[model samples]
Structures are given as C-alpha cells and as structure tokens.
Target: MVAADSTMRMEPAWRVLGCRGCGSAIVECALVLAKIPYEREEADYATKEGRDRLVQLNPLAQVPTVILPDGTVMTESAALVLYIGGVAPELGLVPDVRDPLRREFLRWLMFLVAAVYPTFTYGDEPAKWTHDGEEELRRTTDEHRKSLWRLVEGAVRGPWFLGETPSALDLYVSVMTRWRPRREWFAQNCPRLYKIALAVDADPRLAGVWADNFPA
Candidate 1:
C-alpha cells in the first residue's frame, strides 16, 4: 500500500498497481517517458498480501494492472503500452497510425507479449502449472526463449527495435533483456537488442523508474 508523494496538492491521474522489478516497469517507464501523472502501488504477486490486493483489481493477479483515471481497470502489458501511446502520441513511443513502421511495430509488440512473455509465465513457476518435471520445463522454456530472442534479434533494425525511431518495443526489449537468460547472454547472442536495451537504460527520462525497478 505504498502511496505516491502525499505532498503533491493534486491526486495523480492514474494509479498503477505493479511490483518493482516486474513487467509493470514497462508501464511505469511509459508513464514517466510520457510525463503522465501517476502513482504506483507495489503489488508483489509473490506474497499472499500482494496477490490478494491484485486479485481484487485483476482476477489473474498480474502485475502492471492499471487503474485508469476513469476507474477502468487495464491489464496486459501490450494493451497498456498501446493505451499509453494513444495518450501520448507526441512522445513517439508508438509509431503514428500512418507511419510505415506501424505494421512492424504492432507485429513484434504482439510477438513479445503473445510469444515471448509466456515462456516466463510458465517457466518462472513451473510448479504452479505442473506437478512433475519442473526442471525439464524450465530448461525447455529457457531454450525456447533463447530461440525467440534470436528471432527478435534478426528483426531489429538497429539503434532501436524499429530502426532509428524508438517505440514501446524498445521498452520491452530493454526491460525483458534484464530477465532470464540474463544480460551476459543477450550481449553475446543478441547484440542488436543488447544495444537497444543499453540505450533505453540510459534514457534520462526513465532514470528514476529504472533506478526504482532495477536498483544498483
């Protein structure tokens, strides 16, 4: 139940319920990059208390569950990214509807959330999904994830996932590369994406968000 700065005279327009070091950082980064007004609630799904709180907002109890200013509940990082982009198209975190790269943007965005993210969902806690061969499941998923990263590496256009322009895809690459398989593996095998991750990490707009979600 950690609150945002109470000293502010006005309430933040958005309430983000997310755990630090989790996928929620994507939304947090977006908000910060867009200069949107928001407050974050630490909803650590690993603990019963955190799960209970998130379950109230989202049945799946997922991190990055967002309560919109209108009180609408939003989940799924991809959807949230799109929504944030819609709200702040000037930031260029999402390609314009008319941009040629918009198609590729949408394609890989779905690829990440639909294809790559599930590997972590299932692999991170094999016991939750299966009663047997947890080790095998983790290993299999890790290999599969590596293969997926290779696919992404091939698609990357350089400087960012979508070429010279940055998008939410860059944010995904930035944060996710820090997860399983680790930065060392990404640096060796996915150099293009590794460079993008490093760029995103260095963005001064997200310095505070990155610091809080991924400490020194």
Candidate 2:
C-alpha cells in the first residue's frame, strides 16, 4: 500500500534500474503514477551486457531496482517498493512498514511474484524454466496465465487494488496482469481491474515509462 502510507514531507532522489516491456519497468512507472520523483536507468534484459550490470546490483538481472539517495541500492522489485514507500510513508504507496501490515503486504507481493508474475512472462516458455513442461506446453501455460489474470481481476476491489489511491502493487499487478495479446480479456472478464489499468494509463505522471516502453 505505497499510496496509503507514503508521506508528503519526504522528497528523496531516486534512480530506478528499469527495462523495456518488463515487470521492473512497470513498477518504476508506478512510482511516477504516485508522483514519486526518480531517475531512470534503462537495461536491455535480452542482452548479456544488461545482465552484467544487473548482476552488480542484483545477480538476478532484474529490473525495478530503486537506488536510494543514501546508496541503499535496493534490489527485488517488492523490496524496492517497500523501501520507496518508507521514505514517504504518508503517500501510502505500501502498507505500514513495521507491523502486522508489513507482513501482510509481503504476503500479497510475494504471491504476485511467485505465483502470478511467472505465469505471465514465463507462461510462454514454462518448459525452459520448469523442464517438466517440455515441447508443447505454451498453449496450456497461456491458458493458465489467463485464468490467473481472471483471478487477479476478481481480486481488485475498486479503482485501485486496495482502494482509491493506487499503490506499488497496482503498478506491478497492472502491467503484469494485463491480458497481453488478449487485449480485451480484462474487460471481457474482470471489468474492474481493466478499468483500473485504464486509469493507471490515463495518469500523466506515468507518461515517461510508457513512452519509453510501449511507445507510439
């Protein structure tokens, strides 16, 4: 709940390790949606050179690492989300940073990463990652991915994941949860999150990210 917990008092300098057409970039985009100030460092995930830089910060070579002004260099998209929200908790971008809420936040965020996130990007290639789904598994994985999206769509309670103000989760979920080539799936299925995604798109602050990734 980055949106619900961020504060108006803090204004920290930021640098996000992001990429094109990926989850990390989407979270960086979400920071913009919440009016969080940040600088962007683009990474080409498909290239080895990109992997090398990300290895220095995060061996996983993932995107959405938010470099804190204090040089925290936070990795893990969800960890970065929590870190940024801590700088300005009043903004409510994440849940409370040090209590029952913190645990709850991590629970959902991890579920998204472990269960939901993989179903999207890797849905097209489960065989490569899992080995169990060799040969012709993409079709099944894709179908499962869509089924997961339907679940995500149903989870949305309103204009945002938790409520009115979109949180860090919304950013990640919106981009990752999109229906992909099935563009209208969200609307044809979970009308609510689809509308939520549309609202996230309409946000002017997020223009930089979309322009850099899904550009016209």
Candidate 3:
C-alpha cells in the first residue's frame, strides 16, 4: 500500500503523451501515485502523426514526454518521477533528500533505469548494440537482465521495494515486469519482485492507470 498525504499540494494541469505499455506509462503511474492532476494523450508509435508529435515535443520521439503546468517540457521517466515527488513531498513516492533511505532509493532507481532498463532497449534491437550476431547479443542481454533482476530481488525488504510503502522503484519494476522475459518468467526467477509487481497491480488507486496503459 502507498502512504497518503491529504495535504500535499499539486500544480495546475500537467499534460503527458506516451504510448501505453511503454516506459512513458511509468510517468503516468508516478503522477497518479502523487495524486497530481494531469491530462493524457495516447501516442501511437506505429503512426507518423504520433511519432511526429513526440519528436516535436522531445526531439527524441520518446514516450513519456511531459509538459508541465508552466509549459516546460520534461523527458526521462525516472527524472519525471523525482520531479513529481519533489513538488508533492508528502506523497512519499520518492524519499526526501534528508532521509537516510534516500540513498538506497536512488541506488536502486538508477540501477533500474541505467542498468536494467537498457537491457530491453538493446535486446529488443540487437543491431543497435552490434551489427553482427544480433541473436547472440539478445541472448546475452536477456541473461544479463535476469541476473541483474536476481540481485534486485534480494534487495526487496517486504512486499514493496522499500518495505510496506510503495515507492517509485516499485512502480518502475511493475512496468518492467511486462517487458523483457515477461511477467511469468519474472515470477519464476524473481519471486520477491514478482510479488511487488502483484501488489502494484492490485492497488486500487493505480487500477485506472494500469487499465489505461496495459489494457486487455
């Protein structure tokens, strides 16, 4: 469960556009957990208009590009999560700078974004990593990601990544479960993380977000 902060203040409306089931969806999840008001635009990666709009906003044509209340455009899903938490300190989605656990939170968060998340990027398109032996590259990256996730599994203290309370790390992991080797493989190889994914999946507050991003 997530800790609630009824008094946490939010900015006006923030606009976000991203493809559902992509990394951008994590940004939406963060906003939801932070209880910030937002509008969503679903980007269709397969279409030219969607790609053009994303590229126009971000230049990189990446999902999860957010336009803030003040009309500042922000990208990078992890940084966006931190930004939301900064404004709504009471949300507890991110650890405060003074909190001791803040270091641990950052450590895992970076590992997921910098280390684990890239595996998918390279694995999905092995040619990006190498011109030849694409299959081998994918295989190696997949195994590498599994081992990395095993380490993260051991870092789990309880139901959530940071124990009883859900944090940005948990939300990030929840979305990652749907990628790479898929959730079933994660469940078998990394039971602790799989449990955290289930906890996030069952969270009532996140139900609408999940449905919006990962609809059946």
Candidate 4:
C-alpha cells in the first residue's frame, strides 16, 4: 500500500483507503470536487496484505473504505458521495432537497448502485460465485449491464445527467464507463453518457484524481 500524501500528519483529514482504477476513484473525485482535504492509502485488493488491511477496517474488504476525521468508518460509494455533499453543499454535487431534479437524481443514483453495479460484482469473477456456467454467467451479466446502461442513457438530459448541472450521477457515469463493456461501447450505444464521462474527465477539479486512477 502507498500513502498518497501526509495530510494526516498535520491535521485530522478524511482518509481514503482504496485502490487506483477502482470504484474508489468515485469517492476520491467527490472529495476533490468538494475541496475536502484527504489522505489516500492505496489498498490493492488483489494482494493479500492489501485485502487484509481493508478487511480490518471493513469486513467486506471493499475499496473506497473511508475513515472519517472523528474515526468513523464509511463504505459504499453512494453513501460517501451523499455525505460529502452534505458536508459541502456549495459544491453542488448533490441537488438540494427542494431542487426539482432532486427526485430524479435520487432515483438514478440508487438504480446505478443497486441495479447496475452488481453486474460487475458478480460478473467480474464468476467462479467466486459458482463453478457452473461461469462463462455463461459472465456473458449474461455483461449483456444485462449494457441493457441497464441503455436505460440510463434514455433518461440522460444533456451536458450532464440531470440536464444542465453536473451531479454525483455524472461522477458515477464517468467512472463506471471506464469499466466492463468499455468506453468504446458507450460511445457507440450511449452517446449522452459517453459525453458526460468525457466532460468529467476534463473537469479541472478532478484532473489529479483522474490522472492518478486512470493515467493517460
């Protein structure tokens, strides 16, 4: 594991334990966009030691495990995104409770994490789930994931997921597109989401997080 910075040494800052190129990138980008001070510990789940460390903090050994300043532990990308938005509402990553888009935002956000994200969880390593029809399971999940993306694409507004303003939903599109079916597929099939991903990739606020997690 590698320490991204020594911010923890000087003050009580948020600490993120995650691996590069993983879902943790979503949380990292949220922190950066919120202008939150944080220290990152690269926890490569593929390695035994890294998995052990993460398991200690989170029994599930998930990436994007966050250590709050008050020593509270937080997991799940969507939850962390919401927490950051609450702490830094001025960032506008989450729509206000009164915003009309608030309902749509909440709707799709849960859809992504609950309905879509699980495809990768089970499909990425089929053998872990079962020994039978591993290849079939992967193919089915991939197709299912693509169908879910198409559903999201149909709902996308423009310039961002919710029409004009960017939000955590856009952040999710930006990161998840880089996985599985690949960006090439998205460009051809889900043009709106593809554009949002490219826009997020170019956002100055998240340049460092993108570079570290998805180096050119």
Local error of candidate 4 at 48, Å?
Answer: 1.0
Error of 1 at 48 (Å): 0.2
For residues 1-216, write the lDDT of model 1, one tens digit per residue: 223443443544788898888999998989887777788888899999999999999999998899988789999999999989998999998999999999999999999999999999999999998898899999999999999999999999998888888889999998999999999999999999999999999998788888778888
lDDT of 3 by residue, 1-216 (tens): 122346444665778887888987788888877777678888765589898888888876778888998899999888898998897889898989888778889999999989998887778778857888999989999999989999999998887899877788888888999997889998788888998888888889888788888889
- Tens-digit lDDT string for candidate 2 (1-216): 123235443655567777776776666765664566667777766678887887788766777666776777777767666766776677777877564445645666777777766665576546556777644466666777677767666666676877666677677655764446354776777787677777877777777677776778
Error of 1 at 47 (Å): 0.4
Candidate lDDT values, in order = 0.90, 0.67, 0.84, 0.90
> Candidates' TM-scores?
0.94, 0.78, 0.89, 0.94
For lDDT, candidate 3 versus 4, the one ahead is 4
List pairs with backbone clashes in candidate 1.
none
Error of 3 at 18 (Å): 1.0
- Ordering by TM-score: 1, 4, 3, 2
Better of 2 and 4 by TM-score: 4
Residue-level lDDT of model 4, residues 1-216, one tens digit each, is: 223353345557888998989999999989887777788899988899999999999998888999998899999999999999998998788999989998999999999999999998899889989898899999999999999999999999998999989899999999999998999999999999999999998888787888789887
Count of backbone collisions in candidate 3? 0
Give lDDT for model 3: 0.84
